[model samples]
Target: MKVDPGTLDWKDAYKLLIGSVLPRPIAFVSTVDRDGHCNLAPFSFFTGICANPMMVCFAPMIRGTDGKKKDTLSNIEATKQFVINIVGEKIAAKMNDCAIEYPPEVDEFVQTGLTKIPCEFVKPPRVKECDVHLECTLHEIVTFGDHPGAGSLVIGRVVYLHVLDELFENGKINSEKLRPIGRMAGQTYTRAVSDTFELERKKQPGK
Candidate 1:
């Protein structure tokens, strides 16, 4: 069925957009207020953007009920820094708990019972439970549209990367060891297990 995006409600548009988007990598973001109260939240609309400068991007959508921004965005704007913690199946429940709508003064790190470790470069703390963490500085914040429901695209430049010993060997990261989890449509998720295939590009004849 054909539907006009302009006529559709935000929830309807979100449903269609997320369902068709398939598996999305999650960024369990961590940021702190000026007083040092840490906040943790997950965003499915996240991915790495560049290699030379090592940039990452995540879209923190407006709250469906109030059409207001989330705490993660507020903290980033105030502190100008945050950490991206890779989530795994083991930490999914805790991650979901942090997604709850609590008062701005409430500390998510304490509420979720997650250890908040100090970052070397950023003021925000990193999730000690997460296998891999990227400490980043705020690069830019872009608004999608005029509506309050419009997304805020937060771009960060990677400053420090913390990797657990077991998840890394040589120079590459082991997906199975990392066992990172990704968000799927609806209330589902997927784990990075087993082997991944690779295809080598072929040249037309030999030079």
Candidate 2:
């Protein structure tokens, strides 16, 4: 059925988007405020944007309850740096703990008992539990609106990468070993390493 977004409420729009998106990659983002307070959170609206400059982006929507920016967004705005930690099955529970709406001063790493280690290029620490981490500097932030459910696309350029040795093979990540997880709608998640299949891409018609 064809549905008009303009007629739907913000909550309905969010539900539709998440329901159809199908297992979005979660950016377990870590950031620090100007005063050096640490914050960790997750954003499912995350993906790689450009390979040339190694850019990635995540959208942090305004809170539907309060219409205020998340701590991750505010921290990034203040320090212009963050680290995107890949969420694996092993750390899924702790990552879920971070999704709570904590006050700005609260540290999810400490709250969840996750290990935080220093990064080389960025001020924000990395989640040691994750197999991969992308240390990034803020490239830009494009806000869509000020109301609730509005998203700000936070573009970041990866300056450094940290990957588990066992997960890296032949210059590529071993998905089976990494066992990454993806966000699904309403308290659901999908495992990337389960029931996987592969197919060869077809060559260009004339080539």
Candidate 1 lDDT score at position 152: 90
Displacement of the residue 177 alpha carbon in candidate 1, Å = 0.7
Q: Candidate 1, residues 1-207: lDDT per residue as tens digits?
A: 988876887778888889888689999999988888888999999999998799999999888767788889989999999999999878999998988999878888899899988889998889999999999999999988636557899999999999999988988888887888888888898776754677998888975
How accurate locally, in lDDT, is each candidate? 0.89, 0.93
What's each prediction's TM-score?
0.93, 0.98
> Could you tell me which 10 consecutive residues in candidate 2 have the lowest summed lDDT?
1-10
The numbered model that scores best in lDDT is: 2
Name model 2 segments beyond 4 Å from true.
none
Using TM-score, give the best candidate's number.
Answer: 2
